[model samples]
Target chain A: MNWTVRLTVNGEPHTLALDDPRVTLLDLLRERLHLSGTKKGCDRGQCGACTVLVDGRRINSCLTLALSLDGAAITTIEGLAQGDQLHPVQEAFIAHDALQCGFCTPGQIMSAVGLLNEGQAGDDPERVREGMSGNLCRCSAYVGIVEAVLDAQATLAGEKERAA
Target chain B: MNRFDYVKPATVAEAIAAAGAPGAAYLASGTNLLDLMKGNVVRPERLVDITQIKELTRIETLDNGDVRIGALVRNADLAYDASFARDFPAVAEALLSGASAQLRNAATVGGNLLQRTRCAYFYDTASACNKRAPGSGCDARDGENSQHAVLGWSDACIATNPSDFCVPLAAFDAVVEIEGSSSRREVALEALHLLPGSTPEREGVLNPGELIVAVRLPAAARGFARHARYLKVRERNSYAFAVVSAAAGLVIENGSIKQARLALGGVAAKPWRAHDAEALLAGQSAEPEVFEHAADAALREAKPSGDNAYKIPLARQLIVRALAAAAQGTPSRMPALPASPFSAVPGALHDA
Candidate 1:
């Protein structure tokens, strides 16, 4: 059986013909749309290697079925860059060297960006750690990842201060 | 994951009709169901995706000053809601203490409650599990039973319910609003989860073709606003299953205990409420000795397996510590201080 799912990916509308019920958004993005930036490490919800945004909220794409997200809006790692310019989260990740093998970098950056947009990046490091515990890295590069998130928060705060 | 038929129903009636068919399961968030399907733990022939049902996703206030939480409310949204934190802090804390932010955002309230046990044998198809297969001999009784239940166990199954949010919900006298194919009825949240007396395979009392509409919490402990805390002791500091956890809510009037509700998780087949302990603490003076006595009374009937005997003392200490902390209105104890930069545990850390 095939289901027609209409959803917004990045900033564009997409009407997908999905067949398998168990085929997740991670599979759709990687296999169908050729957006292979979202990696699948564990292929389970335990690892956040396939984190993406649905309706502006971060979720594990590996656990989400593509047919269940009809009329939903999604944002992948490819959507984070504005043509030539990088998103603040991506720039911060690069500046802080938050990636080693870079397999889990995209998911980590996307989760951080979602957290920041959700107003979760605060002064408390414990809260930040609790919020970012979903995404895992094999290289054990948590210090750099946490630093990047904090730095991006500080930069955004500074920009707000200048605007004020 | 294998291919299966999918139906996205917009109404509860349609969902019920679909679920009544052979080998059909209701899907809300798919956080746990999809994971199990991918692992071949559960292979339903048809998935009735009910996430699009708008009526089941709302959070509204009832006429009785109680909050009615729809089944499809995301864990992340419930944890961050001001009303949930103010009224039911234990629920918010438990939800926040469970999975990471990304997973929580994807996990729904109903799915979290209906999630299957984390027993290794249940996941391993080679191992015999009664919950996974009827009349299949139990392998967890003598083999690798560390994470198995200690309080409620039959010769058949020892798998523990994995949801942390359910402990507080059980203790706080919450009610589950369920709509079945025949009629709709409300069951107390404590009664919703069944104990593994003999039939460990039947986890809940929900009948076939039944859909959980919402969870209703009654107004009971309104005065105990600040004197409540949820303590989850897991392997790592975050995103790990509880080794032993306790949720305590105490109300003290004139420096004496007026009321108390305590529940233990990760040590029981269901969210084990300490009704005996609550009876022991009622109308007693608020003191360390009383809390210790209550903890002792709660564990008096606890029968643990070989490797899980440590959970008895660990749960006792957690109960006492949580009660004392709640009485004093102190923040939850941080096992390990957070390091400067945010980092997930380097590898899979075992429970302490």
Candidate 2:
């Protein structure tokens, strides 16, 4: 019993036939679609290493079944840059040295992008820290992660103003 | 995860019909169910995916001022809903205080209500948990049970419900709308979960195939919007289950407490609504003495099930602290940390 799921990944449409209903979004993206930029941490919802933007909202991909999301728009870590130009959050992470091992950087950047899109944190560092608490860096890079999120938030705001 | 059949139903009727199968379970966002499945704690032969049902995703306010929250509404969405937050501040705070932002964005209200306990024994397949395997004999009674239940637990099971959102819903007397195969009915949120008595396996009041369609807050629940608070004490500052938590709402008139609602979490098999405390505070002044008596009344029947006796006194103090914060009134905006004790106003704990 193969279930078909249609998803738009990184602005590309993909129609998949899943033979196993147990395949999670994390597995589908990494093993099937070969988008390994999304890391698999705890596999449980506790760790946010599998975080991605699903329809413009951040969610844990490990806990989400691929079959259930028939028409979701998924934005993974691979989707964050245009040519060589990194997204604002990606650039900010590098500018702030927000990664030591870089294992959790993709999840952190995707979550930070989602946070900036939500626009609830504003410029407050406390809010940014609280909002980004989901993505954990075992390197204890939280100081840099928080700074990067705040810096990226400002960059995105400025870009929006210039476009307007 | 074990292999399972999946069926996405487009309507509530179809979903209930699909779930009528013997080994079928309703699947919302799967934030909790998938985790349990991966741990081999729960394995259903069939999953009735109800995520695509558009009717179950709305948060509508009725003309009579009652707010109806669809069962599929995400935790983050419900917490950020402006009018929903304004009318039910404690519920919003509790929602925000729950799991990480990503989990909250994917976890639905129905999934949160039906989420399994965080009891270590229940998740361990090697352990003998009556809740997991009926009549297997409870191992939590003697094992590392410091985080077990302190109230409403029996020898059969000592697990506590670990939902921050449910604390405030139980306090507000929220109603759950259930759609059965043939009809629909309502159950009080307080009565939705059962205490782990002799039969610890029976967790909720829902029939096997009945689906929780929505949760409704009555018009009267809005009366406490001005003075409501949800306070949680966790091992960490955030992203952790409550060691002991409380939701307090007060309706004060001219410094006199006209009505009060209090409920305790992380201390019982179900959300422990403190009705006696609510009764004790009515017509009394919002003073420290009244709060102390109410807190004591709230924990009157709370006896520890294991080495977790510390939770009894901790829950009592949390009740008092939560009530005192409520009397001071809800903040104009939710604190950056939501319901964490660290988010409390400076010196509030000392004053309490």
Tens digits of lDDT, candidate 2, A76-153: 999989989999899988999999999999899999989998888898777777788898889999999999898888
**What fraction of the true interface contacts does model 1 reproduce?**
0.88
Docking class of 2: medium
DockQ, cand. 1: 0.64
List ranges where model 2 is wrong by over 4 Å.
Answer: B346-352
Candidate 1: Cα lDDT at B105: 86
Two-chain DockQ for model 2: 0.70
Candidate 1, A1-164: lDDT as tens digits = 67788879998898988666667899989998889999999998877899999989999999888888888999999998899999888899999999999999999988998888778546555566667899999998999999999888888778879999
Residue B209 lDDT, candidate 1, scale 0-100: 78
Clashes of each: 0, 0
In the predicted model 2, the residue pairs found to clash are none
What TM-score does each model's chain B reach against the true chain B? 0.93, 0.97
